[model samples]
Target: MSIERVEIAASPCPNDVFILSGLILNKVLTSFEYSFKFADIETLNELALKKAFPVIKVSFALYPEVYPDYQILSCGSALGFGVGPLLVSRKEIKELNFADFKVGIPGRYTTAYFLFKFFYPKEIQKIFLPYYEIIPALLRGDIDLGVLIHEGRFVYAKYGLFLVQDLGTYWEEKVNAPLPLGGFLVKRDFPEDKKNRILQDLRRSLKYAWAKKDEVYPLLKKYAQEPSQEVIFNHIQTYVNSYTLKLEGEALKGIKVFFETLNFKEDPENFIWENKDGIS
Candidate 1:
């Protein structure tokens, strides 16, 4: 029998690398051969728009627009309390006047961008940059404020940046749900059995990482933008949780509310893949 090949794309953040390391390292057993691509979340989002990969990670904000082509896997989601993007600035301003200042956004389609726009909808000047560049741009005074995500949340203060808001906390307090950030999406046309296999392999991969943190730390550090072990540890602990293992309960609820907030009319449930073995 010929082994099938699968191409998957996700970010290089610690949480993502930590979760997928098992599969990437061939520690998790699966029926199909897998190849991985690492890219910034925004780049992955754009690639998804172009249908460039069979499986990819994307911001939840972009899911609705791509619903016709992909179905979200229950596992490998980055959503939880206290894990939203951070709004940071070089200096603390008493009053936020959106029209007067320019802000750096990671990408137009990122959940960070969506939350920023949803809360501060105004005629604000916005510049889109890669997540890594947002902090440096702010420090250089190229932008007045920046919405920081991934490991940026952990290290922005070290750069002397002031926290304008924890968008995750804000979303939790106002919407009363954990903020949905990103998730793995499989092509809707992929075989159902293959999707289930992928989900199972992913769950095993996550569990494997958790069980062998010392073993996986090197892998996490390998791809992480922030090299500090402390920041990488915190990043994985913050984003990968029960939600990463399976999207259910509050995680599922949070996703629903997020789509509703975007005025997505389709039932969110319809877009989530239901594993045939009833595991997810």
Candidate 2:
């Protein structure tokens, strides 16, 4: 029989590499075949805007822009307490004027960018760079402050950068819930049967990885940005959690608040993939 296929795009960060490892390494069983296109989150967001892949990972901030083309999947999200982007600077910040300095952001469409804007709200001059390059650029004095995401969260201090603020902590203080970062999205036009299969495949893949973590460790190492096994383990343990298993309760509520704040076109109920009973 001919193989069924689906194209997917995601970031190459450890958390993503870890969660998708089972599927990428063929350690999980699925009837459908998947082809992957790995890139930075911003790049994935840009391509998703063009409807470039059937399934893609995107910042929750980009959901409004891509809503007409994609619906969010419940599984495989990067959402948790104290797990938001960080604002780091070469020098310590004290009584500083944010607008006076240029801030580096991962992408304008990223939840990191949105969270920064939510806190600062000033039209600060911003520089956008790939997630990995932010530290190097900061060291070279290319930008005053950079929003660090992915494995960047694990290694910023070793570069002699000072944390100006934990964006996740600020968000939790304001919203009283875990911050929603990003998740997998499938094309809204996919046939219902295919959608079910895709969700099932995703759940199974995550289950396999969690069950057989040692087996997936090598795969994680193969794709990790940083070579340190400790870093890879930290990245996976921080981002992948109960929220990743299924979006419900606080996770779902946080998403709703975000969409409402943005005044997005689609309601949370309509935007999420749903079943005959309700949101699955």
Candidate 3:
């Protein structure tokens, strides 16, 4: 019988590429029904919960509600795990008082978007956009504040923008949890033996990526959509954690608090996905 295949839905950016690119470039294909698919952070979420990719699904994990559905792994860095949604304003605005401010978060459905809902519930105005447009809108004064993701985190400072809020800091002080950032994940439905093998392969892939960081940058240049090497490199460095380890406790705590504070409530038991080893 022909071997089965697995598809990977990955966020198409340099940093996200760090986790899955080794598998693509080196082609250490896992022993399972496997193939790979790339998707943005948004589309990846929609596809993940449907339990589409049983072997591996490389995507971002923003909300706690997402954890129980998949067995997730580290992305290298922990403190950066909660790099906090940046509050960028094109103007000279120095402070963000949650009282009467309008902040723009991507799509309002994003974990960051809902995060704003929890932290600044008193803010008078809030807007959502496709992320790429938020900075332009801020430049045009279409909005007062832009909560940027993707390459903006790397370039906003260069544009003379000022940050008003560090949501990551807020999360840490509020819950003492390392901010639950994004990382690689494998679906839970995968059979145990195959799942263990994929997990082992992933661990190897992560270690290899870190060991060969210098070689991985150029491979991601096309995906980050950045023409500037500096920007692309920075983005990759900023978002790609080593991915060669497990998530830490502080980060887990923050991840827990993020879910608890959200009004979109979910059962706590499901927050931790169970593995074939009967462990969460």
Best by TM-score: 1
**Tens digits of per-residue lDDT for model 1 on 84-202?**
99998889978877677999999999999998987788888999999999999999999999999999999998999999988888889999998999999999998889888888888
Shift in Å, residue 68, candidate 3: 6.4
Would you list the rank order by lDDT, best first?
1, 2, 3
Which portions of model 2 show Cα errors greater than 4 Å?
274-280
**Which 10 consecutive positions of candidate 3 have the poorest summed lDDT?**
271-280
Error of 1 at 243 (Å): 1.1
Write the residue-wise lDDT of candidate 3 on 1-280 in tens digits.
Answer: 9866656666666665766666767645555544567665666656666666553333233444455666564333223554667777777764556555567777644656755665676646777676677788887888878887777776788777877777667766777566655555666555666556665556555666777877777777767756587887766566555323455455555545655665435543343332346322
Candidate 2 local distance difference test against the native: 0.86
- Each candidate's clash count: 0, 0, 17
RMSD of each: 1.1, 1.8, 4.0
TM-score of 2: 0.95
Report the candidate with higher TM-score, 1 versus 2. Answer: 1
**TM-score for each prediction?**
0.97, 0.95, 0.79
How many angstroms is residue 29 displaced in model 1 relative to the true structure, after the best TM-score fit?
A: 1.1
Angstrom error of the Cα, residue 276, model 3: value is: 6.6
Q: For candidate 2, which ten residues in a row score worst on lDDT?
A: 271-280
